[model samples]
Target: MLIIPAENAVNWKRPPWVTLGLIMTCLLVFLFYQGGDSRLLDRAVEQYLDDGLLELEAPVYEDYLSREIRLQGRSDRVYDLQAFQQAREGGEPFWLAVSLLSDPEFYQYMTDNRDLLLAPAQRADWLARRVPIQEELIGRLSAFRFGLVPARLDVYTLVTYQFLHGGWGHIIGNLLFLFLLGYTVEKALGPGRFLLAYLVCGVLSGLVYTGFSLGSQVPLVGASGSISGLMGMYVAIYGLRKIRFFYFIGFYFNYFRAPALALLPVWLGKEIYDYWFAGATGIAYMAHAGGLLAGAGLVWLLGKSWFQVRESFFEPDESALDDRFTTGYAQAMGSLERMEFELARHQFEALRQHYPGRLIVLEHLYQLARLRPDLPRFRELARELMAEAANHHQPERMVAVWQEYLAEGESFTPLEAEDHNRVLFASLRHNDLKAAEKAFERLRQLGNDVLTSEACRLLASEFDKRQMSGRARYYQQLMQA
Candidate 1:
């Protein structure tokens, strides 16, 4: 449902107001879905802290409190307040733990259902538990392992782990990244391929997480792994394509556009820094790395031809039109020589339209028209060419025109043998035996050797076409002489 405006120049035809309104609406919707409610978010934090489910340290409390409201469902503020007070008095953190556990899920659900609710943080807790993975699904997918051992892929853990986020902020951040990257990768690779790549990257990410944090009880969740993969593929395919990003330094925010490929190194550097210096709270850097590699590798292997096909759209060559026209003309001529009359006719028609009013082109068109007797407008075109030839005054060109008319059984003034031979060869590029024979007879009477050899070669080609041994032998004798 997210529609990106076309790049480079804005469409002036669309009112600027309409475009601004749509951008504002989408921004508002995104913010609302990503835990943007102030009241509900405060309540969740206070409830958890009062119930002793979360430590009430200054920075930790601030961290929990700073998360955006992610839902607009019926507020349970009164119940949360009562539970917080009761748990505080009884020295029990049961409600606080529940709040902590449920907050992540609430944020995830809000992100999934952004279009349905406009109010911020209304149904946060309702959406937290609907994870999409299942044991039966993994079991079914396991059957395609070929000769590989049938190790189970923990479908329940896979499904539940995807939902068990570290915090509201974590869930919201991952979801936002997913929304931006997932749609673009899906569009480029198509749904089926994109889906396949997504699942593979996710599974590989999980494996990396398990390898690094073996036997750890901390629940790993969020869509970062898949988002990382999308980032990799995007960078690989769109190398220098610019992406605009918002950056915050202290209290100041700035927007900048950079090539997508540049972001890859920056991202990896941040991940490396975090892994070395930051305390481990079960955020799997290895998983993110693995997902990125998988995504990039898959695109490289499967999308080579796709890149070649789409390269024209990204960068067009000015000479391509002329090259295509020349190629089309050559193919048309080949078809004509092979006697593929229909194909030749179509190609010639395209050539005529492509490059209008060339003399050589007109001659070919007229010849093709004469061959296609059933063509509805063939006679009309022939008459037109004849009229054009009549008005043309150069004797050499006129002789060529008369020779063609004579070949077609039309009346024309007679010319000497040498003139006829010169015109015939000039008019026809691939002269066959019939035309050559007439030319040869005229040349023989005039004692001309210049065209004799060419005529004999044409006669030999005709004999070969008819499979006539006698005519072939006679041509061979003439050639030796």
Candidate 2:
């Protein structure tokens, strides 16, 4: 009794959700262009700041001091305070412009405080202090109904404000996160939705920051606030999904996977720790907090039900059977090719027994049965296979298999001249004259013309070898006839 291993048994199939998830992830990666050292924003900023011609405001000049700055070299003046006020009362872009222009001494003060503004924390605090100006700007813009005149809104601070940042580290850090998280959210929401989410998040984060900070003059830029919203959505939707993360502690490199939900606490904890202990790092803990909350709230309100439906579709089915017979057949063929006859026999037998109506298995079983001619069980199997084959289209293969076994079992050629003729020729070729003579007599009794001629030729050769000239000549004349 042979026992096949359990591992060899047919198993369950992979769920379709696995394939769908892989395709979604791949599309996200392609759209985002993830996995690289990203510095496009930095280069853009550098280009805008480096031009030698513009007499930029002192604060703007000081904010970019010692950094690679590239400027577009375009400047305009606000002659109308009501227009500025009107612009402020308008949309986000207008409000952004009003905040910049509202404080005339803002530029001078920043230039004077350049050293203090070098740190991210100080810069964030400085921007935070300007909350009242930003609020007034927002109020004025609201009063104007977000600049109903398209031209007025187009030229406002909203267009340029997003371009500013606290420091180089702040810009680069935010960009990295944006590139990583933005792409995924973009794929889920589409380009239009992604852009909308980004703008809304930025505006919301700015509102929160401005509300909390009151009356300081500092410029804020970069995409952190918006990207934080994406992160929140990612955590909410893919909470149970595993994400591979890389981190380094001192000189040691570590890699691991954790549920997406688990990362939230870790990120929040780190921000809080850094806020109090790491002074003057210039990071915006409050902005990060505001962005996170805003992102989560927005996505929850608008997309929670959809996310739940998507999650339901993504769940893998564990109870499904693989049901792929071709794989098993391939395995059997591989065993057959390796000359693992016993294994092949067992596989073919199981296939025949379990899938009796399958003609292909019956054919394979017939071939295997022919190999074991000495076994009575094989004879019965071969007869059954032949009977099955007769009912099918091609009976030749089954007939050939049966002949091979029959030939192996019985050798009655000695009594049948026509059948024994081949034996006579073979014996003669090997110089077995006695065996040849016995075969020739059988051919003579049969009176088969072709065999008789062949037998006479052999007899003449034998007579000549024995020096019987008369008998050789007589047989030679018969061969001539």
Candidate 3:
């Protein structure tokens, strides 16, 4: 089964150059440096063979003399010494002969018998060993010498091992996860802390892996352990935010959603299960688990503020409409908060046509109108809100609608009149005199509507009780009108 968290869909900051740089460095090292080493070793072996300085005995001798190792793309195809000798003559390129040196038995025999084969000057070359010629030693040196070895811990291996991957698939898998999790993590922790956290997590994980697998000769390579640390940090940083996850098991495929931290236990549990039962698969599950713990522990130390900064991770949207809506709305709101009035106005206006029905959008437009009261958009937004509120039967919303509309020196429409009466009667029935009074004035604007007579009478009575005869007479005239 494969499961992954839903990637973030919005990026609020710059691209993660550090993560990209690390990936590129790993790619270059694998493709150019490590790959070229094998070819160089082949050349060195061929030169020694052509000069007749190299000799071998039966088994090892005939093996190097006749064995064929053909390079097919990135793979090696081996041919038995007898069959290869019959098929090809001695005139073949020296490098083909050199390829035979890769055989562990042949490489061992040559290393052990270097003294018999080498002249005094050649002895210096053998002793210097600048070029790795021993197949077993080369493999071991590539892994244990540079890669992290639990049995022989070296401080440099902690960081270097993260850059050395066993194969293309290994590096690609590590970088994919590093990109997904690392980008956001870098943003949360900031570039400096992000680097620190990454290395620290990797080192801590390596230490833990070494502690558990003590005395084991296997060398751990790849960024999986460090990326696992990022995963742990991801969980801690996101905390309670609902994160979507994608999963596949055999033919089954689906998605699930849960609070970000909820998956932490699931991930750790899988690693533990694999480490104990699937040891033969050759994965360093111990390192992965350790990295996870180290990452989470580091984030816990950083506290909640770091997590808050992580919300900017972007997961590009598949739907164009959603992208525009979210992007535009966010930009508009963000601009307003920053007091960037011109940009906020532009964003608000752009969204006005597309999101005219959204209450939140309309509310923001109304706010813009209050700030720039003369702007026609405010009145338009207020009108749209009034109609929407009426359709939804939201009396409280009409309060702003009326306020905005009236502040713009506009009279109530017939629908506005009906809504005013709804509020007026509801308020009077609920004994909210303040609200009833506010509604009474708007109700007065709807002359000859269904509730006008009762509203006028109510206003006149209230004025008379307050001993305000002049206002009472005005309402009496409105009643006659």
Q: Note the clash tally of each candidate.
A: 15, 29, 7
What digit string (tens of lDDT, one per residue) describes model 1 on residues 309-354?
A: 1432243233786687779889989998898978987888888786
What does the lDDT come to for candidate 3? 0.70
Task: Compose the digit string of candidate 2's lDDT tens values, residues 103-124.
Answer: 4334445646756644665555
Rank all candidate structures by their TM-score, best first, as comma-separated numbers.
3, 1, 2
lDDT of 1 at 166: 39
Which consecutive 10 residues in model 1 have the weakest lDDT in total? 141-150
Q: What is the total number of backbone clashes in candidate 3?
A: 7
lDDT of 1 at 76: 28
Q: What's the C-alpha lDDT at position 252 in model 1?
A: 73
Task: Please give the range of 10 consecutive residues that has the lowest summed lDDT in model 3.
Answer: 70-79
lDDT of 1 at 207: 74
Q: Where in model 3 is the C-alpha error above 4 Å?
A: 10-13, 40-141, 304-481
What's the TM-score of each model vs. the native? Answer: 0.36, 0.35, 0.50
- Report the CA-based lDDT of candidate 2 relative to the real structure: 0.52
Model 3 RMSD in angstroms:
19.7
